[model samples]
Target: MTDTYDVVVNGASVAGCAAAVLYARRGAKVALLERRSDINAHKVLCTHYIQPCGYPVLAELGLIGELEEAGAVRNSAQYWTRWGWIRPEDRVGPGVLPHGYNVRREVLDPMLRRLAASTKGVDLLLGHTVNELLTDDGRVVGVAGTAGGERFEVRATLVVGADGKDSAIAKLAGTPSETSPNNRFSYFAHFRGLPRPEGHSAKAYYLEPDNAYVMPNDDDITVISVLPSMERLGEFKADLEGAYRRFVKALPDAPDIDAAERVTKITGTVNYPLVVRESTGPGYALVGDAALTSDPLAAVGCAWAMQSAHWLADTTAPAVLGHGDLGAALNNYRKRRAENLKAHAHLIADYATARPFNHIERFTFSAAARDSRMAEHFHVFGSRLMSVPDFLSPWAVARCSMVNGRALLRPRAQPVHSGERVLTGQGAR
Candidate 1:
């Protein structure tokens, strides 16, 4: 069978579905193909935390209402560093989404799939896998693949590779790529009745070379994840659950896991290669993990996936709609993507090496823990709401220096009485 459309998108996950919905809403006919046979299938190996920067995209797609209806939790971010807890004051700059959402992929994925399938001008093709690109004189025209064991062809003006980190479309197109090794491994599980984090916010423990997270999500479920450097892999391997539980129980203001019932088996990953690829080609483009895969520690995968889809559509739609030159538009999209993510990606890659905080990182993080203003700047930058240059502005640097210097020079508190004992442990009794 043969079909035609304005755009044919491969891999109907977060990026693919967003691309389909956005493109179709713009009046482009789109065929969204997914190899998965089950429409309700969800990604299991994900933290599923969307940063605040991505909330606007969800609102633009009109999914925020449904997401909230499905019990998505709005969450701010707080960090526990050696110096102290760095919790930003809830401050929203003009036009900035102040908080992020915690929606399990089980709910988020199927919700988006259903949305894309039902949208006008979008043909959601389940059980269809693109096996080959249909090219005309070195330019991609569409794709050829099988749908439910039957050969199918889709001829379109543009093609998108939203597949994933291991994107078949990217491999077939031979996108230039580079990968960096992750020096850490992670384990996570969901629990019911876990005590709410303070202010119901997301808590991250920057335990030097190791890290942990407590993310409260929909349906009163909370996700606790531990990411330890590869040096501790042996300890984790000896007893995964034991080590995982011990790590979680040791966090500052740790959740009441002993009282909470674990509802899911432990899920762990040993290696996650950070991938960066050229996002555009002659008649093809990539978004989401297909274009760039950062360390999971950054927790920006889901957000960046949707944002990249937004970028792709906003920058290239006019050209795809025949109002402008396509090549120039694709180049424009590439530039926009780099301008937004290149520095951030570099920072994430460097941190993924499992190194302890450098002098500047320690100075800034400690200062943030002490000063709410600096904490807000740290939070805003960490949330991916601002650029690296903006976060490290001269004014901000000067302020951080002053804050850290004050914290360092402050006199140590003297005991009220000689018999007074200072408690030195994490969490409450």
Candidate 2:
């Protein structure tokens, strides 16, 4: 059978669904195809935290209030460094706005799919797998797919490839991709009755080289994740639950994650390489993990995915409405994404390869922990509020360096008294 659509989107996950909804809302007839038979398909391996920058997009979609109404808990970021716990600075008011939502993917994915399916002008086709791109004169015109033993062809002016990191459309379009040796694996599971730290919404304990993140989501549940390099994958995989418990217990001022009741079985994935690729072609574009993926250590994937979807929608809406060339539109989309995220990619890449707490990281972390102002800057940088360079600029670094120098230069002296330890300043002889 043959069908027609203004835009045919492959992969009905968050990115695909968002694309379809945005295009449909702009009055374009969109056909959204999903290989999964279930509309509520869940990504088992995600941390499922969205940054504050993404709230604007959700609000624009009219879903932020709905999400809050649905019990999504707001969260701030806390880093458990060797120096101490680096909470958001007082100057920043709270870390919650920058780091944002703690929601489950199981809840989020289904809600987005339902929104896309219900949007006007969207035709959702579940359980259909695209086999090949339909091209005409070197330009992608549509797609050919198989659904339930029946072959179908969809002809559209524009095709969107939101099919994720291993996007078939990106491969078919000959878009070159760069896959780096992330070599890191993560194991995570949900737990109930985990005692969340007071005034700290989420905690990331960086135990040098490897780290564990504890994110408190709705319904008294917290997600605990540990990311270790491939060399340690076997150790973790051999006994996932035990390894997770050991890591959490080892943290300074450790939370009660070990004591928390397990609400789900422990899950793990190894050697999950980070991928970044060109996301546009003659008549198509990619979004979400389909466009680029970074180390999940930063917990920025979901936000980036949704933001990229919004960018694609905004960029292509005019072209789809006949105001510009579709190819040009897609190229513009690629340019925007690269401009916005390339620096972040470089930073993450460096972190993945660099040995932990080298001279530079130690200097930075120590400085930030001592001064709330510097901590605020660090928090903003980590939360994606400011660019990497901006956070690491000479001025910012100088301010931090000064504080660190003072902390280092304090006089060495005897203890204040027996059984009493001075945390920062030196005492008299």
Best by lDDT: 1
Tens-digit lDDT track for model 2 on 1-429? 789898999988778888898888888999999999998887877887888767777876678777877778787877878878777745556543464688898888888889988899999999999989999999899999899988999999898999988898898888888888775678888889977665447888777788888888877788888887667767776877677788767777676765678889888777677888878878888899888878888788888888898899888888887888877888888888887889988778777762577787788888877888787777778877788678889988898879988987976655565456554334433
Error of 2 at 380 (Å): 1.6
Per-residue alpha-carbon lDDT of candidate 1 for residues 1-429, written as tens digits (9 for 90 to 100) = 779888899989999999999999888999999999889988988887999888889998999999999999887888999999987864543224377789999999999999999999999989998899989999999999997778999998889999999998899989999999999999999999977755578888999899988999999999999999999999999999899989898888988899999999999799898999999999999999999999988999999999999999998888888889989989999999999999999999999999999988988898889888888889889989999989889988999989988877976654343245543323111
Give the worst 10-residue stretch by lDDT in candidate 1. 420-429
Pairs in steric clash, model 1: none
Model 1 misplaced stretches (Cα beyond 4 Å): 90-97, 414-429
RMSD in angstroms, candidate 2? 2.4
Cα RMSD (angstroms) for every candidate in the order listed:
3.0, 2.4
Instruction: List the candidates' TM-scores in order.
Output: 0.95, 0.93
